[model samples]
Target chain A: MNNSSDPKKYKNSFLNWIEFRLPIVSYIEREYKDYPMPKNCNYFWSFGAMATILLVVLIVTGIFLAMNYTPHTDLAFNSVERIMRDVNYGWLLRYLHSNGAAFFFIVVYIHIMRGMYYGSYKYPRELNWILGVFIFLLMMATAFLGYTLPWGQMSYWGATVITNLFSAIPVIGEGLKTWILGDYTVGNATLNRFFALHYVLPFVIFGVVALHVAAVHVHGSNNPSGIDIKSKNDTVNFFPYMIIKDTLAICVFGFIIAAVVFFGPNLMAEVDNYIPANPMVTPSHIVANWYLAPFYAILRAVPDKLGGVALMFASILILFFLPWLDRVKIRSCNYRPIFKWFMMLFFVNFFVLGYVGMKPAEGIYLLVARMGLIYYFVFLLLITPFIGRIEKTKKLPLSISNILNNNHSEQNKFQKEVN
Target chain B: MRFIFTILFCFTFCFSIFAASETKNAPKHEWSFTGLNGTFDKSAIQRGYKVYREVCAGCHSMNLLYYRDLIDIGFTNDEIKAIASEYTVIDGPNDEGEMFERPAKSFDRFVSPYLNEQEARYSNNGSYPPDLSVITKAKINGPDYIYNLLLGYVDPPEDFELGDGMYYNKWKEGEQIAMAQPLDEGYVDYDDGTENSLEQLAEDVTTFLVWSAEPELEERKSLGIKVLLFFVVAGLFVFIAKNRLWKSVN
Candidate 1:
């Protein structure tokens, strides 16, 4: 308050004084305030900002939930009931934190799809994409661990099945499984440790997200055309341009989320989760949550236990190597006619695997899951690398500005004629 | 590429509608406490509470509710006080370090039927009845499940051998259940002069259970309406602002 700096130009004097010392304002201004963004980037680009906002929502709601939650085997289930019944707005907080996990994954998945579709993982942006995959891996762990904190039937059995996956390891697997559970089964010790871990993993994710953003800023964002930004005409300031678009996306996204949170809070939830965890009686059907279901499907695609576990872990780990996997010169699928179809097929196959994961590992569903699994591996490991070499490439756009002008010229002949 | 996704979304939606019909012989019953605009019928809830108190309370326990929560189902303060006084709860150790029984208060939890799961199992022939606190939330189409279950008891088919304690329930997964028929005609004499048939009892009890499980349902839906309305208005301005911001770009 007593800073000697002139207050005439500064609306917030303390912030200006702090900025003189730390220079954070200038740093942010350099990195983002006037950051150049591709003018042609579409609604797909909005998801990255949306993911960041949802992460904050999850963290805020999660902290409140953790305050009311009990992490003991004897009291966990009843404590959750108490929270729903007694605590003020505890139901709202619980539902938001629970459903926010799904929403977060939805945004992140779309963000990744955008990355994949435009080959944003290529060239100088490879590290940014790898950092993103790490964040995803951390998110899955956090979500799984948080689910166990409720101590419901689905939470207990899901933890039991997933932990047992480690037992399929060659020799040290059995020891690792016991070490993870702190007992022979998912019990008090497992729940307590999971509570501790879930509380901490989000901070780790936040740190990684910081690095991911830094890496993206190093080379600026990849554009829709997948071409380099050549001059000022090719891009616009991110502040008023991208920020306004993101505000609108957030409103629309928040509206959809409110609809779910308010009206159909339990639509995607497992019914068995409402029951207290009972080791004596197993539920008729056991399944993972929707976000993790595709990998769960890949796990069940194999007959052997060890093989399934290996494939499941391999499926996620393979994304780290995606930068080198698809060696295509053209980035955007819009310009790559043949490769475009394969990419779309892969995207739909992901949803198929998710559905298959929910069904009983029966005849038809099992067959589809296996086929999807095989196609998944074949696309990344086999087709993507070789197709770039054989497929005929389309003519490349000279520049981002040139591409948009061509589109505009076709749409608005009067404006171009007047100009 | 976009076309494929559109088809995938439609296919998944149709599959979801198909999957919702897999309740297996249990028809979806209309309830006063279901759907977007649904609210608990106060009279039905009053009758349902009577059925729960007289019949189901003997086997299962609603351990989550307080005596005071009865106010939501149309009980007055005087009636709640009178109802609570009929039961005794183990309160605390007195000066002598011995726990003593006292008349339950409006704030006290509903008295459970059994002292513990062990007692519940032993008395019920090694099969413990589950808690009814969130039983409606614990099963798919829970009101329908409970209502149909009360009506599901039947004779076994040819060549089917019933276990010593098990009863035949066609709606059950294995067609064998440890729980016998828990409801009968005119089980509880309703004070409201309503019908006391078995089906009426089942429907009323199911309605009360839905309210018990989701006491916040009405508030949630009403708030949802206001929140979504505000969002729609906010969305319009946001869309306009977004369009103006992007007008300079392609």
Candidate 2:
């Protein structure tokens, strides 16, 4: 794959010199340009590229925001206001970063769901899925910290509430919470530390993302047919085909983000966030942002603080065990009718959890949240492991091309008949 | 088609669920700064500033705003200077090493009525009047909520026991609030010959507060439309390109 001997191989003299020295050109060629992706990958496979684009957008916008942002408790609120009002296009940058975080989650969540639905987490791809889970955790942490940088009512209270979750543990729980906050209460120290960590964590995510992509490249991609590649015909190069599909996906994703930033800028933001931090007054509702709402519902489901916190952490940590939990040979839900229904039900349950999260923890919401919590655990823990044993899977195609070619010929015949 | 229907169903369901979950029942109002084509009514903002000066300024402080911000609402620099001069604010120690008070300047933030939160609370029972700079954005449907509250001084139900120093507002959370009704018919004389009724005063000030809460609203919306137009035009070409690229494979 290395073409260092020939100056004519590269696009120009500068690239040729650089390629001779570093071989980065050949590295990219080996990994991306010449990388073999399953030909049958649908639009779902584009989520990873979309998520990566959003990450870059977030980091770029975040840098501009940090330039204008003052992270101190007293100055943070007004600093943000100044950015919005005085700085040229500060509102746009701030809105993009803030809304970018939300959309990043949307894309990443779909990425995870795609992995799950197609068994991308199974067998050789286990490390890839595990690394992705870690990235998700880091993203949640980064987002929660970023939310606190505004230093508004939600920022202050969310900091207080989430940090206090550590105090639910026995013995050192109180001390651990204090250590995390750098104070007995959520104050200047907490804000300073959060601002620092929020800035630092994204680069950490970038490093882990490198590993995740490496892992993916190592084993290649899992296709819809859930069959491993048998020969060159089962795969296509990443250069023109997959890259073009990703470009279109990125364009569509960018359109969505622009629509939000320009039209309903505060659609994902909290109303109370407009108010500066007032520690004396607690807002009536201290809900997390929509991205974290389902987990927040999990946290509030059990009445006991310790129990709720345990269940919440476990809900996320359970993902690490997912590969082993669903030990079935078959991967794609498309071939598993029962598993497809389960996946659909799981999504519906997630929506229910999100709905119940924003509401006050009383009356019917409590009961519904509890039920959602039970189902979330049962599906991931019980049903996933057991369903494959009893359920009859539809016959899988012989190769990735088998089903697609048949479908194409059938469509052509139908067209001819209509003509 | 099923996919499109599912997406629409999800959006509608999510909005309705979230909307119903919000307990606040603030009546909706048509605002000059709402909708796709909406822009700030400059005259209404000016009138609202007048109402704020005469009524709301006694308790609330717009600590985030400078007198210079008035220029956006059609106030001349000379007029803002005149308005700013009427208020006095504290400045730091000079070479003589002493703090001193001086007439406000164009760059100075609107002066607070009290020195600190404790003083602000002491002057108005124990509840400090919150700053009005972001009042509209701080509450759900901020402008509408404020407008409805200003117009929301309905009598309490017979069974309701009113808290001391609290006035009943039909729209305010818990049906009670600390600040008394601050506006009435002919509360202020409008310089532009606009009628000075209670409703008129509320509307003007609500418009002003909305501007303060989101000064970039007009710019954001207009830029959004341009971006959306670009998306449509550029999207068509990209869509065609995508189709052409994938045609051979299918």
Which candidate number has the best DockQ?
2
Chain B TM-score of model 2, please? 0.94
Local lDDT at A270 for model 2: 89
What fraction of the reference interface contacts is present in each model, in order? 0.70, 0.69
Compare the candidates by TM-score and give the number of the best one. Answer: 2
Which stretches of candidate 2 lie above 4 Å from their native place? A1-8, A416-419, B1-14
CAPRI band of model 2? medium
lDDT per residue as tens, model 1, A315-404: 999999999998886788888888889998998899889888888899999999999999999999998888988788789899999998
Supply the DockQ value of model 1.
Answer: 0.60
lDDT of 2 by residue, B1-250 (tens): 4423543565565566646755555568888788887899899999999999988999999999999999988889999999999999889798899999999999999988888989998989899899999898877767888999999998899999999999998888888999999999998999999999999999999999999988889989989889888877777787788788778776
Expressed as tens digits, the lDDT of each residue in A1-419 for candidate 2 is 66546566766888788787788988999898999999989877888988887888889999999999998899999999999999999999999999899888878877887798888999988889899999999999999999999999999999999999999999999999999999999999999999999999999999999899989999899988888887788788898889887887776667777887887787778888988888888998899988898999999999999999999999999999999999888889889999988988988898889888988889999999999999999999999999988899998888887877888899999999999
> What TM-score would each prediction reach against the true structure?
0.94, 0.96
Q: Ten residues in a row with the worst lDDT in model 1 chain B? A: B1-10
> Model 1 in CAPRI terms: which quality?
medium
In Å, candidate 2's interface RMSD is 1.7
TM-score of 1: 0.94
